[model samples]
Target: MSEAALPSRPASSLATPLLILGAVLALAPFTSAAVALLGGAAIALVFGNPFQGQTRTWTHRLLPLAVVGLGAGMDLRTVARAGLHGIGITAMSLAVVILLGLWLARVLKVDRDAGLLIAVGTAICGGSAIAAVAPVMRARAHQVSVALATVFLLNAVALILFPPIGHYFHLGQSPFGLWAALAIHDTSSVVGAGLAYGKQALEVATTVKLARALWIVPVTMGIGMIHARNNKEVAADAPPVKKPWFIAGFLAMAALVTWVPALHGAGHLVALAANRALVLTLFLIGAGLSREAIRTVGIRPFLQGLILWLIVASLGLTLVKTGILTVG
Candidate 1:
């Protein structure tokens, strides 16, 4: 059997204890999202993650639930309004980033599938987007891995830097949230940065990012159709596209809270618990950022991802700061 088929075991005697300690720190009430990520990364880099498979599985399961839980604290009207307002900008940005990323990939001589995966990840929802599109494009394993690693590295940086940058620029809560939602590659990082900023920012960022994530469906379908048209084998062999059901769950939670004023007190508690879960989810994400993953992100692909990200982030910031992008 392959290593994946084997049961999870600690890499070393210290791995379990260290992981336990990291989990405790991540869930601690005072721990910030950035700090949780840093701590987990530190442990993974130093001792390695023995439970890599388990970590990936849990992170996948927990992140969506946490996002759904956060919805309990949101008003449906606000979420709807933010989603509507962001759709146009999100679509435009996605198109620009996808085109720019592809051009940069060609200029850098990166692998076509890898370049496309990186571009899709950057344009949409990071690893989730990459994961959604990869099989349809018949992306190689290394291509998907490199794309994920590049996006993960940038996500770590964005989570840490965005809050300080927002404060430095004296950005309003909603503006900062809008910028984070637009610029950050992953929903986790966007929510983390928004959380670090303030309540209003968190609400705005989460709502807008979730809204932006909805594009994954159409984009994946479009890519699949294009690939199928060029190569019939692609349509025949491609795996079914997975829907982001968490978004609907999130909306349901928001609606429940919105319609029932009596649930507000309980919703607040659930939201708080969800926030803690998100921090832990980040810790798991960081722990998966092993040194091997970093080394796998070779120079050219990393450069392509980095350049594309910088362009998106800078443009997003300028628009938000100049009042060209605002979230109600």
Candidate 2:
């Protein structure tokens, strides 16, 4: 008989995963992902990681699906126009951050791997950037962990801090969204802060940040090329590079919403579902942040990440306020 026709499994067999899922769903309505993630992590910290095996499934499978689902709510043309308007400043911000981060890293006496990881994470998309370039740079496992911890801690802080700062300055939706997209380290934090400000800000922030994330490809590959040129040999232990293919899916869903006649009527529903999925994704992401992981983040790397992010945030806002960077 097929599994569908078979009897249900014993409750003991499904308990942990079910509990975790239930918690996520139960908390999804009232709280933002930022809060949900913290709550999930706090629960895990107290009770131990109940969903250890499933953490991989959430990060690799579910998170990308959620991001793609988000595209269904977006108007691709508007996202594209906003992307074009912001691309120049985005690229410039990345370049300045990386150069300045590396220099500051030297001044701070941090080593090469930590410096590069922090620089890329600041210049591009936080943990994802660190993960992407770590293997290419032949970074040690400890180095990767420390860098990730630094970024994750700062990401949580940014989610809390950026929204109020934006409001305090009385920023318009477009400007606040652009500032969040440019200044925040991770996609979740950017979107969370944007959502806190307003719906229009959320849309603009998500689009611009995802567009900035596309730099992962060139950034990692370029680092690989530079390493090979300087060392004259490729590391045998280097991990295979994976492209951010989900970005294409995100863009495709946006196009489908913009162009497909049959799907047009359901756009609102689709977008709503996507937002819920993103929140669920964030909750799972939070549960993955363990206490042990947080403890391992050294003071030096953390300081490096903190300084770099503050500079990016301050510089981007200054440009925005001065009318040097136009908001869409």
User: For each candidate, what TM-score against the reference?
Assistant: 0.94, 0.87
RMSD of model 2, in Å? 7.0
Candidate 2 residue-wise lDDT, 1-328, digit = tens: 2112323322244446644664567346666766766766665565556565486466667667767877888889977887677566667767888998898888888877778898999888887788788877877666777787788888888887888888889888988888898888877778777877888888888898888898898889888888767674434443455566777998999999899968976876766776777676666666666666766676777888889888888988998777777656
Best by TM-score: 1
TM-score of 1: 0.94
CA deviation > 4 Å runs, candidate 2: 1-22, 230-240
CA lDDT of each prediction against the hidden true structure: 0.88, 0.75
User: Candidate 2 — what's its lDDT?
Assistant: 0.75
Question: For model 1, what is the C-alpha lDDT against the true structure?
Answer: 0.88
Instruction: Determine the backbone clash count of candidate 1.
Output: 0
- Each prediction's total of clashing residue pairs, residues at least 3 apart in sequence or on different chains, is 0, 0
Q: Report residue 299 deviation for candidate 1 (angstroms).
A: 0.7
Which number leads on lDDT? 1
